[model samples]
Target: MLTKRIVPCLDVNDGRVVKGIQFVELRDAGDPVELAKVYDEQGADELVFLDISASHEGRKTMVEVVQHVAAELAIPFTVGGGINSVEDMKAILRAGADKVSLNTAAVLRPELVREGADYFGSQCIVVAIDAKYDEETNGWKVYTHGGRKLKDLDAVEWAKEVEALGAGEILLTSMDSDGEKKGFNLALTKAVSEAVTIPVIASGGAGNAVHFKDVFTEGKADAALAASIFHYKETSVEEVKSYLRKEEVHVR
Candidate 1:
């Protein structure tokens, strides 16, 4: 089996890392640059730095912040939030990001996904989907604008479309599970992962190493990402890897 990836996410609001439950009640975590360095040292396979408020606040991602964080990382870095055009993508990549993740922008204009892939190759484009279960829809619906606005799109279908649109990977975040620290939404993760040929990185609700193992095996996720647990030092990346290794899960 292919090695599974354990990633730590740094959600930035006004340039400071923060974590919240179900996308609200935000609490400060730490400085993004310092957190990035710590995760890199902890044997994280990759890191994600999100300008969590950029889209909602109507501004661009802090390029300087991304540059600073990227400078401290040897692992691959993905930057997202407020990227709306090819120029935006180019700016982030030039700032030293290995991949650019799109959520609101990609949903607003899916052509941007293809445009990004055409210009930078599919390997560099990751489409993030913020999904929450809707009883009205009887399925998960994609949310945008940092989980503030709802889109009339099914999560699974959106995942498939983005893959066809040339997204290299899908960063699937469950709004209902965001910062729950219970476990990943296995049903949602598995559904999206199976719907696309691209790698799926399951986000939100990661509580422990067993949670990571479950997401990889039962949820069929190629990668599992967490924020609060890692940020608060509830667990370390190396510790999780150690547990996964003992459980016979492939890891780097």
Candidate 2:
């Protein structure tokens, strides 16, 4: 069995790490490089650095910051935000990012997903979908521009499309559960996971180890990502992994 991964998410803005609830009211977490070193030491299987404001600010991901953080980690690192072209992906990858995650750019021009995967190999391409439940539609609606704009796309359908476009993984974030600390959106996670063959990394609403366990077993997530909980020291990566181990969930 493949051991599940525990990933610490560093939502960076202006070179500093930050986290916010439902994509608003940001709070400073720490410096990205410092935080990445800490998580890497804590046995985190992977690290995700999202330049949360890069897209909204109309700029590419901070290459200097990505390089600094990547230099400190021994584990796989994924970077996202403001990556609109294959050249951007190459720059980040050359800077040491193991994977490049595309969000708004991928939605606006899906061929970018295929182009990126083709140029860098599918293993290096990750398509992130930020979604919220739409009660009227009876399905999750995809959101963009830092989760401020709701697209006409359905989350599950988009996940399938990105997979067919050659993305290696899908980082699914439930805007509804983001920063709520209740738990992951198991329904959303499982829906996308089942719709695509690529590995799904569940993002948003992870308050404790049990939540991780639930997402893995019920949500069918290959990995679970947490921000506030891990950033604030409310929960450590090892504790979550240990809890999952007790629950008979395969974890590294």
TM-scores for all predictions: 0.90, 0.92
Candidate 2, 93-149: lDDT as tens digits? 999999999999999999999999889999999999999999999999999988989
Candidate 1 vs. true structure, TM-score: 0.90
**Displacement of the residue 211 alpha carbon in candidate 1, Å:** 0.8
Off by over 4 Å in 1: 19-29, 53-61
- Write down the worst ten-residue block by lDDT for model 1: 20-29
- Tell me the tens digit of each residue's lDDT in model 1 across 25-87: 223235677767777888999988787664533234467777887777678989887789999
